[model samples]
Target: CPPIGLESHRIDDDQLLASSMLRHGLGAQRGRLNMQAGTNEDDFYDGAWCAEDDGRTHWLEGDTRRTTKFTGVITQGRDSQIHEDFVTSFYVGFSNDSQNWVMYSNGYEEMMFYGNVDKDTPVLTEFPEPVVARYIRIYPQRWNGSLCLRLEVLGCPLSSVSSYYAQQNEVTSTDNLDFRHHSYKDMRQLMKVVNEECPTITRIYNIGKSSRGLKIYAMEVSDNPGEHETGEPEFRYTAGLHGNEVLGRELLLLLLQFLCREFQAGNSRVRNLVTQTRIHIVPSLNPDGYELASQAGSELGNWALGHWTEEGYDLFENFPDLASALWAAEERKLVPHKFPNHHIPIPEHYLAEDTMVAVETRAIMAWMDKNPFVLGANLQGGEKLVSYPFDTARPLSETLAAAPRPPDYEDDHPELQETPDHAIFRWLAISYASAHLTMSETFRGGCHTQDVTDAMGIVQGAKWHPRAGSMNDFSYLHTNCLELSVYLGCDKFPHESELQQEWENNKESLLTFMEQVHRGIKGLVRDQQGEPIANATIVVGGINHNVKTAASGDYWRILNPGEYRVWARAEGYNPSVKTCSVFYDIGATQCDFVLARSNWKRIREIMAMNGNRPI
Candidate 1:
């Protein structure tokens, strides 16, 4: 039986995720998690796995000599925390059994193994929900053979750290609201404007929702807008992962407005970018967090606290980590993660994988799966430097830093643990800094006095500061997308008055960053019938990272405009590789590949399946 709080629809049972990214490490306790409410006073049934009785039960201890845990499942009417897949609270209940026994909840999302069952009473905590007791210890004297303890195991099904609150009403009326910063309603209104005014190059849709059921909108700006332009390199610029860092969100909206106005005026630069590039902009991923942050003056006092999700989880750290995800891939006999110094901080709720990945995160992941993105930037604040992976440290005992590699390690096997595309990454990161008016200059970094002197406004991610499950690292490692962490400002939460200046500061850099997407290899992977092969993997000969084609059999890879060998591979099809030279003047080199299916193959198998320091 499934645990009470573990809802069926809430579970992420995506097989593709299970085979690759997620890959079976999470607890897969399925089918209505059996949970008995604590209102029972019946005799205890030393259940083989769990105890279920009719409201009344007792305990007759048989094995008092050997101490072990007694696992039991209990139900709650409706877990205020888990609303669909999103977890909103960490509330649970515990019994007042004078004598103690350890209890534990199987963490499906995170492995939670902390709590003393003996003296720590769940009744003392945020009570009345379901409580979990960990490290329980039932003394020998406490469990005599006739021991009839009426002590109810006010046990929680799984552990979640979110606090409970009545769901906030959805904000609809923007009558008196400030239109300066785009609120959810304001963003939707703007989305409507672009769709109607610049209908040719703009299309908008909601990718998913926030924990509080607020819609997460995505606006796609391209030449064809809705249709996939075959072989065109797609780029994405995401912002507002940290809600308090409002610069990116506001800038993205402005960019959308700018592109619409420019397209109408036939401006060359904006016309070219919108014409050639499929740019998807998600102004805010954390609408709930942003809502909390927007209340900076009223209810929420701390800006830093407002930066996190409603649950207080760092969105960047919530994705599948490089080390763990790689280990999972290797278990499936696929490629292995080269080097990772540390592990992602374990999640608070061992409840379900659903909670491990917030609803916002899941939405973004799903969006990525549908659209094949080549190069992108995650805009953020708190620092003014462009950073490149590997964000996590090297394994040389935490002593050996990146670069100045020990002579023994080869280029592919970097001792300092730089990514396979280290050269390109370095160049890309440097380009962003160089384009900026101030960031490239000295005294530009944040987070500390020393960080102010980052190497030429650009730094190797791990070298600057080690982060285990950052978005930049996850994008490069998993999807093989080239994503740079672009830190736009030092002040995390600037007032609305500063929005114009911040946009001016980042305008050129943002435009130039998207321009680089054009200098790469782009092509289509298709069957003999000229039908598109979606999700086809594109690999460059020397580079470690790879790119996958879009649903239209389209793929794009950015390079420094030079000679290269590119290979296109998909399931049940012979991989196609070709050699080509990219002209210095020509922006995107075309190198389309026509894949032939293996005799005993099904075509859809290949086509079907699909943040950050600054972000």
Candidate 2:
């Protein structure tokens, strides 16, 4: 016949015959019956099978044992061939024991292949119902001389393959430039992104809503979640209190982004602050006002007065009750209907009420009540200056005398009495005056109180209401927290171009102002035993500054630098006095006393007793 002979050969029975023929003439000349030509027949051989006398035994390695899954090399040997005439087919048999095997070929048609092949072919099989295959036989029938067989079985389970792909696609996306702007929506979105990215360090809270119904968000940036629960000293920075002051709003947003970035990069100072102290930020307090102001020019069709009405009264004037009245009067004279439309008496609308008297004030008050360690500043603008407390009117208890003494009519002095409650208003007035300076640029007017008042009246359409419900007053009176009102001045409404210059001019002064406030609070006088001594007298003789401590042993005094006598006295002891010299920029002083008993009175009593005793 041709090289395609041997139609009568039985593949299973001809093993020895083929080996013998391969070594002899017919097999040697044809290279052992051209076993490479029958390499494709190996696909039917079940490569893992070992032939015994009666049957073939097949096994799989790995997790496939005792399971009907035949898992090993599925693609058989590397060098097997298939003839074009005889189609290649494979049959797999399963058995629970070493004997009595059953063919699974009928139900799993996918387990068989019928195509001409060259090279070792995989015995394709379906993962049907799992069977414990103690033996599997792969039979190839009706193969030409060129056909050969081999088999490969898989040993890995299906679930592991699925799991690998499942995990391969789950990487989080990272894009830079994510938080470069101050858009409210962008900020909110960035916060969400940050929270997701850094779950261990960040949390956000919705404080309330702005007047325009937009969500007013306050982000509590901290490392420890417990910090919020502990009610620790919280530093709060609120921007855009006046809707038109847009730079602060933008700056606050940028600051938040910067903080988040720096924190993620392992900045120690920021990280420590976020963990140790609660940092609260209200980026835009007056969102409604901002939106209105930002859209003013476009909507109103006027660049000179943008959305801001020419008659719109300044919010800074709405401080004390008198100032509020002045503001209301000015508003009535300017845009009578437009002025008070948004000005409500509720605490949130007034800084004094908001910080010291109103509901919003209660929010901060509650915070202060819990955290006595707070130190903060409220930022405002109109004049580039810092104004401390006692802005409204001094409390009635301050006096000029430095020591405890009975009133003398020759001095024309007012009623002076030492009580448990003494006014430190004078102390506050002098301290703030000495520490900070109001802007010196005068508005082309004479330097007289009346002249200034009249000029303000002409511009504002009312007498200057200098004092009102102010936050600084409340901070000094109600809490131990050190707070200051920072008035960042601009010659006119701040424009985008001037913001950098304005900040450059005021940054150092602002920090120094804060430091002074810090030192003043931190360096209060204590007694010799380190206990805060009550009623300790501090006299700044340069400006004739004099004040007494309260029951709490807290005193605040401000005066020019000079040589002065400071004294402390108690009822049972001789008074103590000291002469000391002070210098400018010396923020505070600590002087304590240990007094001895007065001997003059006791000696006089002894002399009187001797006279009575007839000595």
Tell me the alpha-carbon RMSD of every candidate: 21.1, 35.3
Off by over 4 Å in 1: 1-179, 297-303, 324-355, 396-416, 444-447, 452-454, 527-531, 570-573, 596-615
Best-matching candidate per TM-score:
1
Tens digits of per-residue lDDT for model 2, 1-615:
011111101111222111122112122112111122222233332212222211222221112223334532232322322222222444455565536757654464535434224332223344455444433444443243422333323332222222453244223323133322245676577667766766676677755554345665666666664254332334556655565555555545545655677688987755655665556666665555566556532112111221121224233333334323433444346423443211123343444533323233334444444443344555654333334443453222333345465766354223321111112322322233233322333232211111232222111111122344555444443444334544444221343433344343433333333333323211234544555555454443333223444444554433334555666554444667776554555344444455555676776688798984634
Model 1 worst lDDT run, 10 consecutive residues: 15-24
> How many Å off is the CA of 294 in candidate 2?
1.4
Candidate 2 overall Cα lDDT vs. reference?
A: 0.40
Question: What's the lDDT for residue 360 in model 1?
Answer: 77
